[model samples]
Target: MKIERVKSRVSLRRTIESGTEEQRRAVLEIISTVRARGDEALKSYTEKFDGVRLDSLRVTNEEIEAAYQNVSEEALRIIREAAENIRDYHERQKRESWIIAKEDGTMLGQKITPLDAVGLYVPGGTAAYPSSVLMNVIPAQVAGVKRIVITSPPNKNGTLPAGVLVAASELGVKEIYKVGGAQAIAALAYGTETIRPVDKIFGPGNIYVALAKREVFGQVAIDMIAGPSEIVVLADETANVNEIAADLLSQAEHDERASAILVTPSMKLALAVASEVKKQLETLPRKAIAVSALENYGAIYVTETLAEAVEVVNELAPEHLEVMTAEPMQLLGQIRHAGAIFLGRFSSEPVGDYFAGPNHVLPTNGTARFSSGLSVDEFVKKSSIIFYSEPALQRNAGKIAAFARLEGLEAHARAVEERFKK
Candidate 1:
């Protein structure tokens, strides 16, 4: 990491979207093929991208049962514990259908209902982490979604990782399909003969999958268009240099585009953290990727004051913000735009990523300025309920008609007036 004297808010966006025109075009073509050919296209694309020729897309019960044996007992125990924490946290977010009946005999309320079905896209990257599977699926389960389906790229043998399957089985999310990439997205959005269509899609993937989700958005609702992982550490002289360095590198190792920044008022602390980052980067397995990110996007900004540091944070609206000041809670009020805030030295970014009750999947690339992390709200729809007693409508109809007429909506006015015409 490099340290620079703070002047202005640095940008946190890529000059262009991660996907190239060719990728978008390819995703579009894949989507069209899946829409037209359905399961055939799914099989073809699965073979082309994942290098697996699957006789069936669905993960059978036999596979699920076999997956249990593959996962370790300790792993299963940890997953179970984490699932309980996740469930408990999200159960608080569950909403109930509510109504308010007035003395006038008019009732108004909202009906909170879960989506008919939801699709979660689990990445089959260089390594598979069951944490993502649990993070994405648990929220939908808490929302009471009738059906939760998963689509993940299979290994060369066309099977999901044992940990991923074990976590899904623990959550009772058995509707998993062993397909992935843009093709899997197309299958979810348009539906194949084997896989059922979902009302919304969740989870993140590489550029191609991101582009596919973008293309299929209107055909089916999708979670936000996520970008690379990022973290910003706001530190002071009291902060531990090693901890700050490790936290920044934590997000940087996520991918080549992942950003790790340190903004502090103390130049000495900033310099120390930068040096520490260099020392730590030497040992990280993903050093090349982390080095590229730190070289291009990472920085240690020496701000004039802590208040100015917070201002810079608000402007960047990073996905993960860590406050390592003397009293982290005192600075909480100053922050306005972070996907997840980690207070004090003990609250490392990964705590929220894995075991923490809060969501790991968060707004990225400055989207925390407007959007939010995945929650029960994403999996449910709210329908407004309206009712009016005959006496209430009769008394209010004339005024309603006049208000409608004011908008030159004569038909709307007539609809209100017809109840009173007799």
Candidate 2:
């Protein structure tokens, strides 16, 4: 990690990855094929990419039972507890349809409705993200989404990972599919013979999946085009250098592009943390990846004051912000950006990632400046509700017609005036 003295607010914005022209064309072709051939295209792509020929696309009940057997009891217990925590946190975000009525018999409000169906894309292969399953599913369930589907690429044996299956099973999500990549995304966007098209899609995947999501945006809603993981530590001299180093590496190990930064006022602390990070990087299992990340994106920034450090953090608007100052909570109001904020030494970034009850599917690549993390709100839609009585309409009809005519929309004015035509 390199150390630099900050002169002013700095940006950590990286170019959002838009897949290559070849990849985009491939994604478009895949989506078109899925729309035309349905399950046939899905099966073809699954066998070609996942290297597993499947008799069916959906996971069976028997397979779910077998997944339970393969998973340890201890792991199941932890998954269940994490699910509970996530569900509890999201339940608080659920909103009911409401209406406001006035004496004039005019009622206006919003009607909140959960999406009919949503598909979650879990990345498959050597790594199994049961955590992603929990994070995406629990919120949709809380929002009252009826059908939640899980789609992941199958292993060589044509079976989904045990942990991923177990987590979905714990959440009572039965519609599991052994399909992945751009083809799976296509199937989710356009209905296949076996798989129904979902109202929206959630979760993360490879470049093909991302491009497919981008291609099918108008057909169905999607979670953001997530970038690599990022963590910004706003610390002071009182913060633990070792803990800060450990936290930064946690995200750095995620990807070669992932960024881990430490913003502080003390040059001595910055130098110490840089050294600590180097020492810790040596022992990381993903040393090669972390080293690449630290060499390129990681940094220790020294500021003139703690206030200046906070200003830098706001400018970067990192996905995860850890405030490890003397009083972490005192600066909470000052932080206007950041997808998720961890307060104090104990509230490490991973705590929110795995078990702290907050959604880990957060805005990345400085999107926190305008976006937010995944939540119950993402799974539901709100329709504006309006009702006007004859009296209410009579009171405002002239003004409404005048405004409509102001826009030169005769039909719009007529539509409202038609109700009161003599």
Candidate 3:
């Protein structure tokens, strides 16, 4: 990691990736084929990309039962506990349909309706993420979504990973399918013989999957087009150098493009953390990936004051921010943008990633400035409820007609006046 003095604003914003024209064209073809051919298209693409010919695309009950046997009891215990924590946290986010009744007999409120169905695409093979399964499914379940689907590519042996299956099973998610890639996304959006179309799609995937999501967005809602992971640690001289280095590397190891930064007012702390990061990088299993990330995107910024360090953090708007100063909580109000904030030495980033209740699927790159992490809100839709009594409409009819006519909407004005005409 390199060290520099902050002169002005610091920015970690990377250009949002729009897939190459070739990839975009390919994704379009896949989506069109799936919409036209349905089940046949899904199986053909599965055979071509996953290198397996499957007569059935859905995972049978027998396979899920066998997956339980493969997963160790200890892993199951941990997964169950994590699910409970996640469910408990998201349960608090649920909103009931609320209405306000006025003395004049006008009732106004909002109705909360859970999405009928949602599809989560878990990457297969080595990229499989059981943690993702927990993070995405629990929130939907908490929102009372009736149908939740899991889709993943089958391995050479034509079975999903045991951990992925186990995680889905633990959540009581029985709609697991043995398909992945852009085709899986297409199937989720458009539906096939074995799979039904969902109201929305959620999950992480490769470039092709992302493009497919973008293509199918109007047909079905999608989660954000996520970028690589990021973490920015705002620290001072009182912070521990070793802990800062370890926390930064935790995100760097995620992707070669992942950003890990340190902002502090202490020159000594900055230099020490830079050295510690190098020492720690030598032992990481994904050393090559982390090294590439640090070389390209990681840095240690020395600011003139702790307040200035906080300003730089706001400008960066990193996905994950760790405040490790004399009093971490004191800086909470100062932080305006961060997908997830880890305070003090004990609250490491991984705590939020796995064991902690918060959702780990966060806004990446610099999008934390405007967006938020995944939650129950994403699984439900809100509809405005309005009821106007005869007296209420009679009183407001003229004003409503005038307002609508102001916009040259004659039909709207007449629609409101139609009820009042003699």
Model 3: residues with Cα > 4 Å off, grouped in runs: none
Ranking by TM-score: 2, 3, 1
lDDT of 1 by residue, 51-144 (tens): 9899998998999889999988998888999988888898899899999999999999999998999999999978787898888888898888
Give one digit per residue, the lDDT tens place, for model 3 in 1-422: 89999954989998889989999999999989988999899889989999999999999988988989999999999989998888899999889999999988999999999999999999875566899999999999999899999999999989998889999988889899998989999999989888999999999888898899999999999998989889999999999888999999998998898999999999999999999999999899999999999999999999999999999999999889999999999999999999999999999999999888999999987899899999999999999999999999998999999999999999999999999788
Separately for all candidates shown, the number of backbone clashes (residues 3 or more apart, or on different chains) is: 0, 0, 0
lDDT of 2 by residue, 6-124 (tens): 95569899998898999999999998999999999988998899888999899999999999999998988899898888889988888889999999999999999999999999998
Query: For residue 187, what is the lDDT in candidate 1?
Result: 90
Model 1 local distance difference test score: 0.89
> What is each predicted model's overall lDDT from 0 to 1?
0.89, 0.92, 0.92
Model 3 error, position 107 (Å):
0.6
TM-score of each: 0.97, 0.98, 0.98
Q: In angstroms, how far off is 299's CA in candidate 3?
A: 1.1
CA displacement after TM-score superposition, residue 355 of candidate 1 (Å): 0.3
